[model samples]
Target: MRATVIGAGLAGCEAAWQLAERGVSVTLCEMKPKKYSPAHSYEGFAELICSNSLKASRLESAAGLLKHEMELLGSLLVRVAKENAVEAGGALAVDRKGFSDGVTREILGHPLITVVYDEITEIPEGEVVIATGPLTSDSFAQQIKKLCSSEYLSFYDAAAPIVSFESIDRERVFFAARYGRGDDDYINCPMDKAEYEAFHEALVSAESAPLHEFDQQLKVYEGCMPVEVLAKRGQDAIRYGPLKPVGLTDPRTGRRPWAVVQLRKENRAGTLYNLVGFQTNLKFPEQKRVFSMIPGLEHADFQRYGVMHRNTFLDSPRLLEQDMSLKKDSHIYFAGQITGTEGYMESAAGGILAGINLARKLRGQAPLILPADTMTGALVGYITDETVKDFQPMGSNMGILPPLSERVRDKKKRYGMLAQRAMDSLKAYLQEQGL
Candidate 1:
């Protein structure tokens, strides 16, 4: 049986690859070049719309553990990311264009996978997985609503801005990553106490763009909030949050700056840089005016200004099965950000699970159920279990996994035990599948 995967974003690409690897003929549909999402520009699969970094790379951190798991599962995205990775201290970052182009080439070159470059206005009949991501188009989204009911979708997300390297005042912006962990990979704009205070006041008082009627109905993902929302909390909120300068010290001063705003390299050429945590919905003009006030961005040229877009999701607890298959339709599965699983890594994990299950069904085999001890399995269980109320999109966190069989008082020790248990279960599962 042929497997159809909708929306060739990160999850879709991963899902299609997994299916193809398992000897399943796959159809991968992407609405790009012909159509583009608000945040997406390149005509490529698994596009990195915002920051290039995929969070931390340490095994102790939840995101790091997820990456490790994906590697063990032979994830295409994770493999390519490692090949094209750029230095970003303890985080796994990549050359955005290289990463996407590599994924596109791999998928398109796959003999068993057929590439379709047009909008899917309606849900196609047959075995299918919807990995459309956060920026799914209106017509297709409406069709999904008709199939799954209106209550299972959402809209309104925000992205950070990108800046041209030529415009930055390099002398003022020191090169360093937080905690001096990685080599000099980040461009940091140091601020004095007075400068930080002034910037904070300006940000809080800055006029924000009026949300469209449709955008007003959507809720912002807590993990990816607009800078304006953060500023509204208080004058010092940003200083403590994105603008915090704890780990960084100015080379000239040999002391930590009062506050710092970091810009990370977005491309292999290092021509473009993205504001590390400056996701915002400020008006374009205001962004120019306010962002220019940074110590090193006095004449910064924006490659892409931060903008707000809608992100839709289902109340997963009420809608999806443990394998990311929809309850109403066994043949139809959902993965990625749309399933209320946040972050690039989390979305990819969902794709892996859905693809495995789809392949199993095609083989006339029972579904592959992931053990709950692992972060991957816990995420699937969290979304599919009916007991959860007020379901929100979640990233892989230690909190989602079950506690250790024996209680450990130290947080680090407890997390280490959890990670160990997860890996043990995943290893056994892989061996059982002959992977």
Candidate 2:
């Protein structure tokens, strides 16, 4: 049977790839080229709208464990991302264009996949999976609103800005990753206590863009909190967050600075840099005026300014099954950010599971409800858990996983044991299912 996957974003692409790989025909639909969202520009699939870095690659980290699970499930995007990786210390950073282009090429060339360039206003008949991403078109969003009540969706998220590497005050910025993971890969903008207080004053006092009455009190996703909102929490909150000076000694002072603004490489060329954890909804001029107060960004030229946008997602705990399918309709499923799974890799992980479960269903086999011990299973389980009264998008974190049969005290050893147990369960499931 043929299945339809909406949107060529990360989740949709993986969902399409999995179905196609398992001998099921898929029609992959994308609204790009003909039309583009405020955040999207490239005509390629699986576009990276935010930072190019996919976070830390260590198995102990949550993102690292998710990628491990995805690779085991044969995720097309994960493989391609690693192939186009750029140096970001231990993070799986990729060249955004290459990553998107590689995915587009794969989808267009796949024998069982047919690429359809059109905006789907109405849900298609037969089997379908909606992975419209955070910026779902208003028309399709209304349809989803009708399916799942308006109260079940949310529309608040913001992204950080990117600055030209040449625009930075290099003399004021030192290169180093936190705790010196691999090598000096991050360009950290050091600040003294005096500098930080002055910057904080400017940031909190800066003018933000006006929001709609409906959006004025928006529920910003916890994972992508706006820098301004975070700043308002407390003076030291930001210092503890994005500006925390934890792991490196500045070459100039031979001591860790009071605070630091880290700029991560946005691409392999290193021409662009992401203001790590600086997501904001400040006006463009205000962003320039305030953010430039940083020691290394005095005359920074912004390629992309920090802007807030609406990100609509369903309350999946009440709507989706463990496999990410709609509880009310077995033939319909949800994946990606739309399914309330946060982060780039987390969304892709949802796509993989949804695709696998859908394939199993097509083959007359029971959908695999992964054990809670695994990261992927914990994440999926959390989103699909009906007991969660107030549903929110969740990223793959070790906290969500069930406690081990026995506790191991040391931090690294504890995480290592958890990872080992998860992999063991995943391998056993794969062998038993021949997937």
Candidate 3:
């Protein structure tokens, strides 16, 4: 059987790879090298547009548990990310270029997978998966709305700015990761207590771009809030949130900084570095005016100023089935952030499930149902449960998983048990399928 997968971002690439591995013919459609999304620039498949870090890798964390499950399933993205990993302490961070290149090579090299470079304006007939990510194109987005016939399906998002490394004042900055971890992986801009207080005040008072009428009605996702919005909650909100500097002690001062702004290397060449968690919606002039106040960034040149964009998602609780198949049309499936599953790994998990179900449907076999104990199964259940109200997009968190048979008071021990249960359930499922 043949499958069509749209948007060669993280989830789409994973779905295509899974289908090809199952001996199914696949067409991977990516609209790049011709057009670009507001946040994406590369023409490559599985581009890591934001931070390269895939969050924590220890089994105690929810993202870590999801990664463990994906690894067990022989996920191509996970494999490549591990091979291209950069030092990030306990987090699974990768060399972004290497990771993207690896995925692009593997998909193009697969004999069963054919990649088409044009943007798909309409949903094609037959088996299909829409994995177009948060920054889906305007034309395709319209097509999706027409297909679903639903309004009020958006979750607005934004991106952080990238700055040229050469433009930064080296004398004012020090090279170090938090707590001296990761060995010079981050550039630290130290802020004295007074300096931080002044910056905090300016950030809160800075003028933001005027929101459009439609933009005003849209809700912002918690994971990607604009810096100014974070500041408005309180004078110290940003200092406690993104700009907090608790780990490192400054060599020059022999004291921990009042606050620190970090810039992470964006490419192997180190020509550009992105503001670590500084996604913002400040007007361009305001971005320069407010951001330049950082001690080291006074003369910094911005390669890309942060901008906000529209993010649309189906109310998955009302639209999708347990296997991520659309209830209205069995042949159609949805994956990625648009399905109300947040984070790269969670989206990839949805893609894997969707691809497997599509393959099963084509083979006239019974659809696979994952046990609720597994992280994969839990995420699918969360999206498909009609009873869930205020169905916002979510990352894999322990709160979504079923509670243990016997409750444990310690948080770490509880997470460990959850991970163990999930793995055991998954192994049994795999054995049953003889996979």
lDDT of candidate 1 over 74-93, digit per residue (tens): 78999989888999999999
Alpha-carbon local distance difference test for all models: 0.83, 0.84, 0.82
Tell me the lDDT of model 2 at 434. Answer: 71
Worst 10 residues of 2 by lDDT: 265-274
Q: Rank the candidates by lDDT, best first.
A: 2, 1, 3
Candidate number with the higher TM-score (2 or 3): 2
Error of 3 at 346 (Å): 1.1
What's the lDDT for residue 248 in model 2?
Answer: 76
Candidate 3: C-alpha lDDT: 0.82
* Candidate 3 wrong stretches, greater than 4 Å: 155-309
lDDT of 3 by residue, 1-435 (tens): 899999888889888888888889999998897788767877777888658999899987778989999888878889999999999999999998999999999999999999899989999999999998877788888888777777337547676877767668999999987887768888999999899989988888988786654466656678788888888898788888888988887889888898899998754445457787788889989999889999889988775677676666888888888878888888999988889777888888888888888888888877777887788887888778776544556567665566677867676888899898999999999889877
Model 1 scores a C-alpha lDDT of 0.83
Error of 2 at 382 (Å): 0.7
Candidate 2, after superposition: displacement of residue 97 in Å?
A: 0.8
Clashing pairs in 3: none
What number of clashing residue pairs does each candidate have, in the order they appear?
A: 6, 0, 0
Query: Lowest lDDT 10-mer window, candidate 1?
Result: 385-394
Models, CA RMSD each? 13.4, 12.5, 13.8
- For model 2, residues 1-435, the per-residue Cα lDDT tens digits are 789999999999999999999999999999998888767889999999768988879887778888998898999999999899999998999999999999999999999999889888999998998999878988998888887775457567777887767668888899998888998889999999999999998989989897654456667768789898889999988999999999878989999999999988754445457788998989999999999999989988675677676767888878888878887888998899998788899998889888878887888989888777788988888787776554545666665666666766565787788888888988898888776
